[model samples]
Structure formats: C-alpha cells, structure tokens
Target chain A: MLTYEPDETVAHALDPRAKLAFQVAFAVAAISRPALAPLGVLSLLALGVLLSANLSPPRVLFGYRYPFGILCLSVLIAAVTIGPPWIDLADGVRTAHAAYGVGLVLLVSAAYVRSTPVRHSRAAIQSLVPGTPGRLLGIGVSLVFRFVPVLRRDIGTIRDAMAARLGTERSATERAVVLSSRGLTRAFVRADRLSVALQARCFAWNPTLPPLSFARADGLVLLLSVVLVTVPLW
Target chain B: MSTDHEYDSVALVPESIVRPFARAALLAALTGAVAFVSIPIPFSPAPLTLQVLFVFLAGLYLGPVWGSVSLLLYLTAGGAGAPIFAGGHAGIGHLFGKTGGFLWSYPIAAFVIGALVHGRTGFGFGSIDPTADETPSGGFFDSLEVRDPATVGLGRLVVALSVGTLIVYAIGAGYAMWLLSLSPVEAVAQFVAPFVIGEVLKMAATIALVRDGRYELS
Candidate 1:
C-alpha cells in the first residue's frame, strides 16, 4: 500500500508550482555559476526547507542517498570523460567542485519537489504549462503515478510462476529473458487499457481558466526566491 | 472467403469484459511492492528490480483494460505521497521529473502486454480461480488445462507475445531516449541492449506461466 504523506508544515504548504519554479531557478542559477559557491548556497536552502518542513533527519538522509549516488557516479563519469583538463595537485579539487555543485543542485531540487503533494503539484504544473498540451501532460503524470505499484505486483506474481514452472534452477540468462519479454508484453497491454479509460474521462483544456489566488505567503516566498536567485547574479 | 466466419461467435459484452478493473489495480499495487527488491548495476542510475516481471504478469493476468487501470491506481497512490515506489520513494515530484517518462509508460506497457496475451484464445480461458486453493505445495502448472489444438493454437500465442513485447520495448526505449537525450541507436546501446537478454528470458517464463493458467485472477 502507498504510505507517503505530506507533513503538516509551513514549508510543505507552498504550491508545488511555485516550489518547482523556485527550485528550477535555484538549480539553473547555481549551475550557471563559475564554480561551487552557488551550489553550496542552494544546498543550504534545501536544508533550510527540509528543516522548516520538520522532516526527520533519517527520512531526509534516506531521500538524499540514492540520488546522491546517481549524482556522484555521473560526476565521476563526467570528470573522466569531459575535457578542459588542466591537471595538478589541485586537479581533483576543481573536478570535485564542479561535479558536486551540479549534483547537489539537481538532488536538492528533486528532494524538495518530491515532498510536495501530487494534486497541488499537478494543479501548479497545469497553470504553468498552458493550453491543452498542459492538461494532457498533467493527466499523463497522474496516470503514471498510478501505474508503478500495479506493475510491481504483477511482476511478483509472474516471477513466482516462473520459479515454479521453469524450476529455480534455470540459468540467470534464461530467467532474465523470460522476465523481460513477458514483462514488456504486460506493460503494453496495460497501457492500451489506460488510454481507453483516459479518453473516456474527457481530459481536455479550458481556455478561460479560473485564476489562482496568491496569498501573502506566496508573495513572501516569491520574494525569497528572487533574493536567493539574485545573490548569485550579484 | 468470407471474413465473418473467422471471428468467434462468443457473446462479447464490452462492459462485462472490462469488469476486471479492481483485479488489475490489485496487481499494480503488488508491482510497487516488487520495486523494493533491487539488484545494483555498478555503472548506472537505475537498478535492476523484480519489478518488470510483475509488470508483464499484470498484463497477462489482467488483460488490457483492467491491467492498465490497476497500474493507474498504483501510480495515483504513489504520487499522492504513497511510499509505493522504487525503494519506497514516492511523491508528485517523482512523477514530474526526468525519469517520469519511464514511470508514465507502466500502464501503457502493461495494457499492451495484456491485450496481446488476451488475444490468444488459449490464454483467455484459464480464469479458474487458483487462489481458491492457496496451498503453496501445489505442483507447477497445476491448474492449467492445455487448450484443444483444433480450437486454439500456439501460433496465436507467438503472434500476441511478439506484438506485446514490441509495445513494451517501444515505450521503454522511447522513454530512455528522451530521458537520456540520445538517438535511437545510442539509447538502445545504453538502455535497451543491456536489458534485452534478460527481457527475453523473463518473457518466456511469463508466457509459460500464463499459458499454464498460473495468472488467472480469482
């Protein structure tokens, strides 16, 4: 069963759209900077948001690790593969600085966004994207969110069946082949069904949409984003 | 040759056929549970999980409409802050970002697989509730009744599986291309190729199980 839930905190209260804009802006600004300073600032901001949300250290740390692993690996790959190599004792420093900076920004941005509520996030995205495509995108996002677990369960059932029928003694190669081919087929069939349902729901666009109400807090948050973003520019 | 005779005379009610929505949903929920078990890939951001196995089975077990609907429900729960995702990671942001394409393709992929399998006449008839007897001591292929060769043949099975596999790979590879910013060739090199062998084996097992009536929902 699904167990993630939004914490009742002020930081978690921002509209997902606003948070997304700010997070993207923060990440972009940090990325554009010459070095790691801006990224450090962004990380601090993420920490601040996490603290404000009153999320526990364990939960936040857990969230950080997987993405951090991806970020580190990517950075390592880039450092080895990308050019602009001017080496010395300080070479590691420069490479690490660039990699960590980009990695941290992306990770923090994802973390902040993930903590936000889905419906609100969708509404926010809908507001930002504009027109029919935007609405469709929202629906797409919604449907995907629902699909992951369902697919997970089916996989388990099939896996057990394979174990039973093919015997657990099947070679690794054989097991993998069976899993992937059958799994892919299932995914396609499920998609077809979902598409039909979505079509029936009359997912569409409204040109004259209702305006979003901006509270005093939204303004304050926007101002804060401006300040954070401008500091790098300054 | 008249085309009318080719079609089966079974009374088909679309609504009645579509009623397995809940079963599909249940299967999808189980899919999320499967994501918890991951095998590390030394060089990539993604880990190999037991997840895909269930995804295919969902299609086979639930058929197109219900299978996909089940996945949708799982995704909805996850996005709404349900911890039913890879490593129990869940939320709206996961739905919006880079890996979103792959995540979004789940239902589509499942439905395609399900529809393909459902098209095979032998695959469709195994709905006797296996859960009615929950003893794990039952032998492999216990509940299955091999279809009459004259009435339904394995040729259709091959055709259905081929089509279903194509759909799954199309979605997965397409998503990988977009997410990685690679050309089709490059994307397959990085994503699809590495996984192809494994996929093939999994499909065979899945096909066998479904053919043997292991997937018929209660």
Candidate 2:
C-alpha cells in the first residue's frame, strides 16, 4: 500500500525536509478548520500538488478507498448513542471534518514518501538531527522502508500457499496463528543475518550516510511551507 | 543450510555495539509490517491487530531496554511519515487522535513486559552467571545466593504477557474515554471489551512460538 516510485517530478525534486515541513503545515491547516471550507481548499491544493508530483489522481484515490471506508465507519460509530438525544448527527459532522483533515495530511505524506528515495530520506533525517542515535535511527528507518515491500510480498505468498493447502476450511483463528508464526520466524531469520552482515562490514556509530544537498527549489518549497503553516496559525 | 536458532534475534553477542541495534531495527520493522494484519469483528471499533504479538515478542526476546527502544523507533519512524503504522497511516497527526491511547502506550507496555519477563538484572547483555557474581571466599553478600536471570526461567512468560495486555488496555481505554468524552465504564464497554478474545488468541500464539523457538522467552 505504501510503495515508492523512482521518478523526477516537482514533488520528487523538493527537499525531504521541506516536504516534512509541508506535512506539519497541512496537518495544522486541516485540523484547525472546523468547517467544510478548508477541505474544499485542501482537496484543490492536494490535486495541484499531486499534479506537480506527476502522480495519478485515480490511483491515489483508489488507495484511499479502504481508509475512506474506515473513516465512514468511524463516523457512524461516533454518531451512535443511546437513550435521550438519540443520535448525534453533529458528532458525525465533526468526525467528518477530522477525517478530511487526516486525509489531507496523509496525501502530503504520501507524496513525499512516494517520490523520495529511502537514502534521501535517511540523509535528510541525519542532516536534520546529527549524532550517533540520530544516525542509527535514520538508517534504521531507511532499512524498514526498504524491507516493507518485501515483507508485504511474503504475506501475499503465505496467503496463497495457505489457500492452496485448503486453508479456507480452517477457522480464522487458525489462519491468524499460522500466518503470524511463519511471518515472525522469517522476520527473525532475516534480522539475524542482516545484523551479521552489518557486523561483517564493521558497523560504526558514525558511519558515513548519504549526503543531502539543498537546491534553489528547496528554498522555494521551504518558503511555501512557511506560508502554508503561518496562514493557519494567523 | 543451518538450524535456525530460536531467540537468535535477541541473543546478546559479545563486545558488539551495532549487532543489537541492527536486531532491534529489524524487530521494529517487523512490528510495523505486521501491524496491518487486522481482523474485523462485526461489533467492535477496534479491529483485532497483530501489533501486540510483535510488541510482546520484542520484550520477551530482547528484554526491556532494547525492546522498548525498538518500539519507540517504530513510533518515531511512523511519526516521521514512514507508513510503518497500522492501516498504512503515517505522520505525527495520529499521536492525539482516536487510537492515541493504544498507540502511545506501546513502548511503555513493551517496557513493562520486558521488566516482568526478564527481571531488571537480567536486562544485561548476557545471563549473569551466579558464580561470577560470587567471590572466592564469600559472595559480594555471602548470605544471598547469586540468583541471576537463569533462575527466572519460562514459567512466568504467560503471566507477563497477560500483564502487558492489561497495561495496554488500561492506558488505551483511559485515553479512548477521554478522547471520546465518554465515561470510564462506557470506554471499557466500547473500546476494551470487544477485543478480549482476540488478545487471548494472540497471547496463545506468542506462547506457542516462545515454547518452540527457545525456553528463554526473555
């Protein structure tokens, strides 16, 4: 669900730091506004940003369906109450506002993650927060992003293998247990070897990580982030 | 081909700094990856998530410091927009939203679980040999036997898991109540009650894994 693309677009071109700043800006703007007006503005802005990033709207919206469904369900759940006052329709409206805020926030993050390479993101974190723990955390995060897709694929393979073995006849509990045991064991093995390999290379607390270079566009993106953040606070 | 050692994921290597960090990193990544394994129930807002299985295992395997450290890394990475959270959601915004309590309590729950499973002294890299702690003529304190982690053993693993689950529920339900502006009873009813069965199943899975993988769950 969270796949990255290798491309050269405006969204890809922006510094990861600026994109991170934009995410905070978008969150504030979306959360601070109570009315639907902000969502409309947000939707239009998200569209423009997506276009700049050269990402397809239909695919993005497709990815959103599941979360959108969950949001709708939450709105329904939040609306329910017993006895006097019956149902709180206003709560549903408020939840919807929050959902829109979350959606916009997600969109900004999606753009940044989809476009930026794991190495670039790592470099951004290392540069932003220098030192040993910061370097480890940044490298660790990059490692996770790199491995997520592989693990997701493993789940798919396990599900198919189970299905082939007539797993459909088994109870949900059985399936959960089998899948978890398999997945966790595999993860454990991979982690073990990875650590050995890292050790073989002589892991250093301050090993050289990728470098981050701020460009002219980064300045523009930073300025835009400042404007985006300031408008909501003001 | 080699026999995959159980608990190799958390075994303390001698004189190595980065091995533990790498292992913790992978475990943290595993936690994030599996968090999306959600099972829907007809009546509950909280779908059954596999997060606890990983979280509990981290503590039971790595002990408190590294286990807690790994979970915090997961949270930090997820907060930094890594899509390493449940439902593929990322960013700092979820820190205060609907799932706030459950999400916020993860590192602490992991810590508590580790503390219970691996006693405080056991948290050291390797098991402290009782004899090593004991001096030639007399012990550091001759009266007290050199009881180290080997004494803790696996008998109480289930109990530790149960306590950790409660910790998560207590904090989660409390936060959910506040966020929803509901009474304590209502919060328990709404947020905590529905997921009890799922949690039991998860605990059972962890127990089976621990028993099979290695005797030392800590």
Candidate 3:
C-alpha cells in the first residue's frame, strides 16, 4: 500500500499534519455517525477536496472499483440469500450507505497522501509524537519507505530463485514457502547487516529530525475541520 | 525493557543505545512489505496474503515487547498515510473502513504470538504450554526462532500458529461484522471461510520452512 507520489497539488501545498487531520476527521465522520444527507454531503465534500487537490473524480472512483465492486456484490448476495425471492430494500440502502462511506474514505485518503512525500509523512508523525518515542517512530517509518523498494526487489529475486530451483510447475503453496523463507531470511540478514552499518557509522538518535512547519492554510483547514466533525454529530 | 546480558536484540546486533529502536523500525518496515504480498481471491474481499505469517513471525522473533512495538510502528506509518496496508492502501481511513478491525488487531495479535513464542503469557483458555516455564524453549524474539522452530515438535508449532490465526480472525471478523453491518453468517463467509484453506496453506508453508531448518535470522 504505497501512495506517496510527488505532485504540486493543493493538498500537497497544505501541511502534512493538516492533511492527516483532515483525513482523520473525514473518516471519523464517515464511520462514527453515517446518515443519508450527511453522507452525501461528505461524499461531495470529499470529491471537492480531491478536485481541489487536482485528483480526478472518475479516476479516484476507478481506483476504488475493487472495494466498491465487492461491496456491491455482497449487498446483492445479502439481498438474494436473505430476501424472500427478491432484493430487500432496507438492506440494500444500508449496504449502499456503508459502501459509500468506505469509498469516500479510500478516495480522500489516497488523494491526500498519495501526492505527499514519504519524508513529509515522517515529519508529520514526528510532529504528532514528541521526545524519544516520536524520534524512534520517525526513524522506523523512514526505514519502511526506504526498504519497500528493496523488499520488492528481494521478492522478485526470491521468485526468480524459486523458478530456477523448483521449476515453474511448482504449486503456488510451494512457491510461497520458498519465497517467504528466502525473502524473510534476506530481510532479517539485511536488518542485522543494517545494525552492523549503524555500528560502523556510529549512528546516534541525535541525528537531525525531519523539519515540519505548519502554515496559515493549515490553521484554516483545522478550523474547517471543526465544522467537518460537527456536521456528523449534528 | 531490560537491557540485560540476555539476547536482547539491541545488545547483540549493533551493540548500542538506540539500536533496539532501529531494529523495531526495521521490523515494522518488514511487516509493511509483507503486507504488500497480497493474493486476491475470486470470491472474498479478504485476500490470501502472507501478512499473518510475518505478524506471527514478528512475534516469534521480536519477542513480546519489540514484536508489539514493531506492529505499533506499522499502524502509525500506515495511519500517517503510508501505503502499508493491503492493496497498497493507506491512511487512518483503513482504521475505520471495512478492514478496520483487522488493521486494529495487528499489534495485539503480534504481541500475543510473540508472547506465546516466548511463553511469557497465556493468550486465552490454555497456556502456550500445558506446563509453563519462566523462559520459553530457546532464543529471544524469534521468527519461529532458528533453533527452537527447527527442533520443536510439529504439534507445538501448530498450536502456536493456530492460536495466532484464531486471535486475528476473532477480532478481525468481529469488527468486520460490526463495521460493515453484515450478518454473522455473511461476516464469516467473507472473513473466515474463504481464507481458511489459504491460511492453512500459508501456515503449513511456514512450518515447512521451520521443519526444513531454513531458519536463518538468529
């Protein structure tokens, strides 16, 4: 689940913390108290937020096709299985509303964070958490982004090694075994080697923390967030 | 928490003050990457992925504290907008979505798996071992620890993996029902039933690695 892709969108212009808060408020509003008009408004509002951030509505919907599709299928199944030879209207509405909520969440979240840098996320995290715990957390998140590509490559290598050793005719289960074993062993060994590298560099926690500077726009977003939260409660 | 002479990962790996934290960060990353290895099923929304393997492995290798610590880091990273969740999805949105229950349970599940691996505490019902001991069979913080997993009887590994899978499903499917407003049968159909065979296969694969003595990370 990697989303951050560099872009000069309006969402990207806001502080990472503000984006985080906006997404949180939006999700909370969606799940905590879901209703008809409010959900529709939230949906429109999410679309507006995405558009303002330079994301296309159709594109976001297309991106969410997988989950939305399954949600539709399940609702249909429920209607068919439990209904008396027909679709149940109430069940259908309820499921549709829930699916809407889910879709809104995925779209807004993907749009907001997809444009930001992994470093910005690290900075946002550091800002929320303070002192030693935050410091450690910031570093760990950095490592996750750093290694995702490395691990992806390692997985590819594992697949290649498996094909070479076990031949292509092996079952998916056999491939998974070798892939997991070899891939994880490589990851762990690399982790240990990282420790050695840390020792070699004499790394310390006092290394410069990622810089996070909140802006006036962020304050406005937070103020707007109050209304966002209140709407669901209202 | 204790930086003692025991095989605390921090002391032995890099020998430093903040190295444990570094290792924790690395483990979280590893878990995130493991999450990306998703295999979609034709029928169920929940896919067959190796996510649980790593989560349990995190517990097996990182011990209770660090294993839980790494999972916490993973949630934070994903929550803060990293695409660390399944299907490369990100943000706190997942924390409240259909899969929210599963995402929320990861840390607790990992901690349980790790604790059982260490025999530090009982998860529920029966303890990890019928006759409990202060220290577990071998190694501190193992991904099915090299020595112990390689040597331990198959029954014990099955018990450990079974307990871990059940914990994940209980919270995962429970929340899935509540969050998604599905009936009990529907919830089970979506979250548990489809994944049963795949989960078992993944578990068997992990155990096969253990039995084959391929456990490398000490």
* Model 3 C-alpha lDDT per residue in residues A113-142, reported as the tens digit of each score: 666777787877777877556756777887
Tens-digit per-residue lDDT, A1-234, candidate 1: 223356777756666656666665655555443445556666677676656666554565566576446434433433342335632324334434544544545444445544565556556657776653355345445544566556666667778898789535765534554554455457656755764664465322332232355667767777777776665565
* DockQ score for candidate 1: 0.08
Candidates ranked, most accurate by DockQ first: 3, 2, 1
lDDT of 3 by residue, B152-217 (tens): 577777887788888889898898677666778878887788788778877887788768755565
What is the DockQ score, from 0 to 1, of model 2? 0.21
User: How large is the interface RMSD of each prediction?
Assistant: 10.5, 6.6, 6.0
Runs of candidate 1 with Cα error greater than 4 angstroms are: A1-8, A13-48, A55-64, A71-215, A218-234, B1-19, B38-48, B96-98, B115-189, B214-218
Model 2's interface RMSD: 6.6
Off by over 4 Å in 3: B1-23, B34-47, B121-148, B151-153
For model 2 chain A, give the 10-residue run with minimal summed lDDT.
A202-211
Instruction: Estimate the TM-score for candidate 1.
Output: 0.53
| Model 2: per-residue Cα lDDT over A1-234, one tens digit each | 555678878888777887777767766676565356656877788778777777777777677666557555566666766776878888766656665666666566667657777677777777777555566678788777767667767766887899899985775556666777677667767777788777676554445555566899888877877776665655
Which DockQ values do the candidates obtain, in the order shown?
0.08, 0.21, 0.30
TM-score of chain A of 2: 0.83
